[model samples]
Target: MPGRMERMRAERRASGEASFFYREVAFNADAVKVMPGEYFVHSEDLVITTTLGSCIAACLWDRQAAVGGINHFMLPGDGASDDGGRYGSCAMELLINALIKRGATRRTLEAKVFGGAALIAGNGALNVGQRNTSFVLDYLRTEEIPLVSQDVLGPYPRKVCFFPKTGRAMVRRLPPAQREAAIALDQDARRRASASAAGSIDLF
Candidate 1:
């Protein structure tokens, strides 16, 4: 028989959530994996995790309300299309809106950004990592959200884990052996973005 955690995760999956929920044995707590083009918000003791190469993951928290969320985006902006959380513009809006819906206030929101590495060398035009980092910083500035911390703009991929309710985050720089997989994933996402014509994103 499935255990309590397994059953709960199964239910979440049935509801069409973008990410999969599970238990992180290291933290001994419930966790969710936020993949590229996805975001998750919660007010419970849940850890949200994601791996990135040239992509970015922004963790937003409203300490006053004890609510927070995180998003993983592959590109800087949609330019005019709404590719869900695949673009930074839509990802930021979605994460903020979701947090507000969970009782968080914009005025008290704080941000911690991660990822955005120049994993692909010798390709200035394809260096989406720098662009993504710039976009997220500008977006936060324009929205007046305080940026508490950030780990970005390097040559290494990262694995990030964020605790929503407590607003805690951890980032690990992956070794060269893992960089190939991360780079491949980001490249594929970029290709899909280029091929797809999405809609415009709505702001909250």
Candidate 2:
């Protein structure tokens, strides 16, 4: 039988109150994986993980509350679309809201930003990574959230694993081959975003 915490989580999902915005995968074991355009917050020490190439993932946690969340955004802003976690605006909002719901105060939040690498070989003109990098920084500044650490802007991909309650983190730099894979992922996302109708792009 599921424990009390598991029962509450299941109830939330069944009621559609805890929307992942995308499909919610089964989260068992000791770790949770967040996909692009997704975010998760928790008060446990369970590992929250994501990978990034040109995209950006921001990890925010409150020490006193022992809670944290991570968000992976594909772009900087939602442009014309509504604020959704898939976009940076909505993503940040969702993350912040989740943390608060987990007993964290907005003022006590500290951030660690990652990703925003120049993943592709010759797409400097696009500046997707740069935009993502700056957008999060601007968002944090405006929100008055202290940025405690960041590893942004480069030419390689990264895999980030964060433990919320313990505030422990691990970053692994993917090799060139895997970096290319990351680039491919972003390219596909960008292409799809461009193909979508006007006023439909999200920040993530």
Candidate 3:
């Protein structure tokens, strides 16, 4: 059998082919850590993808304007914690704000939610995927954002591809071993959170 690294490389190659070719943009802590209070915009044909275990992506589109955008986040921030921009609160906020800035109103906006996969082996309470999924749904409901569609919450990891220009999003479920890797990525995120609390440095 192929080793872990070999498998990862294969997946990367496959993902490259699966994804739409376009201008890429990446965000992180030092790069202003896309918080709930902030927003951004891009005019190019954009593709945003994030692997999921407990995280969720909110894709917002202004169909009449022919513009769209997506945000990826890990939790549903309820103003209870610092959130560190990992929660759905931050993600949803950024996405909505970005759309509003792009001239999209609540009534004119359409949404597609993705991720929140329980790809890890676990029970209900411990299932971060389920929690994240619930968080996003509640947020959208309270915010009154018309949810056009969704593909979320299952035992399989997913790779998402979103085209902002056309408001088209595709999700591909990863195999079991790939799902395990996605869970590992989630664990790594948690570890980084702990390290951050201790004033330690970590990077992706």
Candidate 4:
């Protein structure tokens, strides 16, 4: 028998299937990993997913243009990898660039950011959630992209759905334990990326 929290999480995951625009965007690891330094874009529709631990996602919308995009990244990429700038710097740029491509600019854009949850129970040394949140806020400030809303930094994982057409972002909090598991998965991904990079450098 599952506990109350477990049952609740199961319920939420099940409910997600009922959404009309529930598109499963894959990340890293397995066939479903959104790497630490990547971005994805889509038009005005509900983009929904679950996240835990230290990973963070940002959602951008342009009201006048009825266009928007979302990005899920781990660390703030330093522009060294093939990803160009997949982390926060790249993530922000990707979303903005997509919007610009669609006729939206910083002067006309509205943004809403989510995730960056600290789901673990212990005083973990890897507070990627906090770091991610800080990086995003700083980036937005530096770029002058005007953030209209945000839901970040908590003890719970989150389910975020953003409607680009309407510029509305919906967020639901996940249980604490569930968030911890998500964090564990995130750490494992970092380990894998590190090992892969080490192997590549040796080959060079």
Candidate 5:
């Protein structure tokens, strides 16, 4: 018989939702990192991890089915271009669909939202964190998914670890060094988005 980790990886592979998997030394367990524009779902005893600055990481779980998934999104909505999980609209839908496909029902779904830190120092108009935060909150309300818990809208980046099968989530505010790294990551994402926009000429 296959072990839990093996079964988990097999399921992930079958569903084409595999991310970066590794043995997490700190937790001494099988783990996968869900980066920006990425999400993962599983029904095994595995940990899903992600680091967030301005981006939002939403963990949706169905207790009855014991299935859950997490998504990391940088922007509020999907624009003219289809950028996969980078946009909240696409990310949320992808995660919910995957969970339902894994036997989770929308009626029993609950959410824990994290990140959305205002790490960037500038005008309020440029705060993507606030925008992302608002989008996810409104989405959950509109979908009628119960928001069980949340830690959002602060000045610090966060590292989130989520256990899917048990619906347990742990969050740690990153220290100074890690905070700088997170800010750098967010800045790079912004630059990429700007460049992508600049290269495209939209038709009116």
Candidate 6:
């Protein structure tokens, strides 16, 4: 059965449907690496991936519309400026609006959230992770979106891969070394959250 599916997928790929999910080779499939304050949306099976430590990533799917999107935000709320995806509010709005424009209905949206880790404890720094987790949960609740799944508020970082069309996700806790790198990236993203560099909008 697996071999037969592989042959079918190969034929699909050969015919130029480049984004179908193939489990065995999925790690090497064409992918979009979403940065902090970035998002990706698709009505197909393209992979959207991100790494997070203290930030949050939200994956939203409209079951009826069969479309989904994922966003990564550096901060919990708007920070003096509304120009970037770094704020969860802005990031969430962007993804929701995009999905709606693409024929998804807000009434059918469901959500899965990830990330928000306390990497550096007791540093007098803002507990950004907890804040991010709280903010997103509240936002979704207020918007009436059902929270179906989540893995948040841990001591480790995570790498998330989301399949938009199927609304399936895989999350792996990073190893210690890569966890440290994710912490570094999270700190950098927070520091530069107010900057004007455009965050990405990827289809795959």
TM-score of each: 0.88, 0.82, 0.70, 0.70, 0.88, 0.81
Worst 10 residues of 2 by lDDT: 14-23
lDDT of each: 0.83, 0.75, 0.60, 0.60, 0.84, 0.78
For model 5, the stretches where C-alpha displacement exceeds 4 angstroms are 1-18, 193-196, 199-204
- The candidate that wins on lDDT is 5
Give the TM-score (vs. native) of candidate 4.
Answer: 0.70
Clash number for every model?
1, 4, 2, 6, 0, 0
lDDT of 1 by residue, 1-204 (tens): 986557656664311134587779888988888888888888887788988888899999999999988888888876445467777898888888888888999999999999889987766755788889999999999999999999999899999999898999999999999988888888887766544653322111
What lDDT is reached at residue 149 by model 1?
A: 99
For 59-103, candidate 4 gives per-residue lDDT tens digits of: 777778888766676664443454443356766776688678887
User: How far off is model 5, as Cα RMSD?
Assistant: 3.7
Q: What would you estimate as the lDDT of candidate 5?
A: 0.84
Off by over 4 Å in 6: 1-28, 195-204
Per-residue CA lDDT of model 6 for 104-184, tens digit only, reads 988899999999898987743467888899999999999999999999987889988988888998998988878677777
Model 6 steric clash total: 0
When 4 and 6 are scored with lDDT, the better candidate is 6
Residue 13 in candidate 2 has what lDDT? 39
lDDT of 3 by residue, 1-204 (tens): 975334433553211012222233442201111211222333345455555666677778887776776666654554335543455676566566666777777777788888777665546576667777888888888878788899998777777666667788777888876766787777676554444345322222
Give the C-alpha miss distance for residue 119 in model 1, angstroms: 0.7
